[model samples]
Target: MSKLWLNSDKNESVFIKLFQIINNKYPNYASQWLNSLKDFGKDWEDEISNNISKVFGPEYNDRWEEAATGYAEFCTEALRAQVFFEKHGYYKASSYSDIVKECYHDADYMKVRYLPGQYLSHYIWPHHQKMLRHFVRELIPKIICEVSIFYEVGVGCGMYSQRSLQMMPKAYGVGYDISDYALEFTFNVIKKHNLQERYEIKNQDIISSPIEKKADFIISQEVLEHLEDPQNFINGLYNATRPGGWGYITAAINAGHTDHIFLYRNPEEVRTQIEKAGWSIYDEQIESNYMEKPIELRPTIVGYLARR
Candidate 1:
């Protein structure tokens, strides 16, 4: 029962191909798989990009078809899993029932994503490089002289971090994330820009990071929507910042987008959460798609400035 790749009316071969590579040789179910792709189309294009980011992602410019094919492979894997489980009466089902738990193995859903996704934000929005400059110039106060530390959590590929460093010229940062692959990607980007002499970053779960450094400021842009645990992340933010230190968190609110677990219908909810976690809003701003500035939320961006 090999998986078969399904194509939409538009010849877009959804994620079924990727699943096929991992599951069986080919994929099965034409209509069902096509429907899933249709369902996924309900999401905005940006959401679609984020959902399969590990595939086509950001860096690769002209490879969306390839990513879609990869996604098909992933879907086939799901089908194979379901068929295998049904045939062998594989322990019925459980809370964590996405993997093959036949005899003695815990190899579940870490199958793909070993290479980490390309930078979706910076890639989709080339002006994000300029936007980073805007943030640095707007936030970095004319303060005491020294190589200041600008911390960026969830620093995907260090693009923003590098841009910020370029704007300030004497500042470095600790780009933090939960994935070593992401950290490595950022490291490579930083090295390409030759900023390693100043920056010190690591692949760490911000929610559980033990190392504490009181940053002068922190920036987390376009990352909150993906967080499944916003509260703990807020607490982690509190712990990461020094007294009177500040943060810039930009997110997509209320928009039914991709990987959006903690929905923010409005900016106040995020502000409220941060306040509840013992932080205060130094300032906050909202940008709808109508604005000309890059920071303007085109259907999903919400930006906040808070103090800890």
Candidate 2:
């Protein structure tokens, strides 16, 4: 295998091992991806590596190869979706029911492939890493109020809620998701961290059954593009947040994935939608997957720290 992309002294064995597994399975693309990550600084790499180890325990050792395969397969599927989007100007999956039937209801696909791949992408994918950084550094720190209660909408891999509980030790998290697999994964994650007492997972859809009690902090990441009516979803988020509360919401723009339904053309479209929902954008970041692309074709992530 090629030399590790991250610093040798960092003791990032879990991360390096995952990379090796990917390289062994896919030599060419893995090598190119690792090479591209050489410029990713040590501090950022170290932080992500540590978070990965914390979130995934010894079970990851046995499943590293499976996770690596999942990552590769997921990327392949995403690329195919992106190509289709470029050709047709929309995501392949159009309806919430279709996504629920095809992606969310498939237990093997969610547990063994999509969820694991998405968990790794939080650390490996450059744009995802940027969004994670924004969540940890920019969004989390800006919440000056005491976060007694927080809500994590669409708790996919449960990383964001786990991070929130970690950062705000006194805060309790209520995670809502429509997918049973997602709730299960999130439960296991928080249980692994011994945060089960501080966090709770509910198999509920906030879009349909909005939280009756408002929270001081709410975070919904990469969920906007998954919904058919994101404006209403945004309004629900706003309603679920207490006055003077803080929210961190993220959406994908011109980015295609197997289950992504609604298409966001640009960051301003997302910003306007959030503003229309009565959120005052406090801080925001837009990170593109590519350094340069036609304005309409760029795959980007837009994250906002908003006040209710």
Best by lDDT: 2
Which regions of candidate 2 deviate over 4 angstroms? 1-12, 28-37
User: Where is model 1 more than 4 Å wrong at Cα?
Assistant: 1-120, 123-133, 141-147, 290-298
lDDT of 1 at 131: 42
Every model's TM-score: 0.56, 0.92
In order, how many clashes per candidate?
22, 0
Candidate 1 backbone clash number: 22
Cα error, residue 9 of model 1, in Å, equals: 38
Give per-residue CA lDDT, model 2, range 1-308, as digits (tens). Answer: 54555445644456565666777786645764465356566665566556556655543576667777777888888889999998999999988998998888899889888888887777777888778877887677768355899999999999899889888888999999888998898888788778899999898877777799999999999999998999999999999999999889999999989999999998999999999999999898998876577868888999999999
Output the worst ten-in-a-row residue range by lDDT, candidate 1: 95-104
Q: Model 1: how far is 228 from its true place, Å?
A: 2.4
Question: In order, what lDDT does every prediction score?
Answer: 0.53, 0.83
Q: What would the per-residue lDDT of candidate 1 be over residues 1-308, giving only the tens digit for each residue?
A: 31223332332333433333323422342343333344335342333334344334344333454433434444444345434433543323332112113210222222222122223333222233234434655655432243378788877556667666666677768888665555666776677666788787776767665547778677787766556667777777777778877777777653332233455666677777778888787656554432442322223455667777
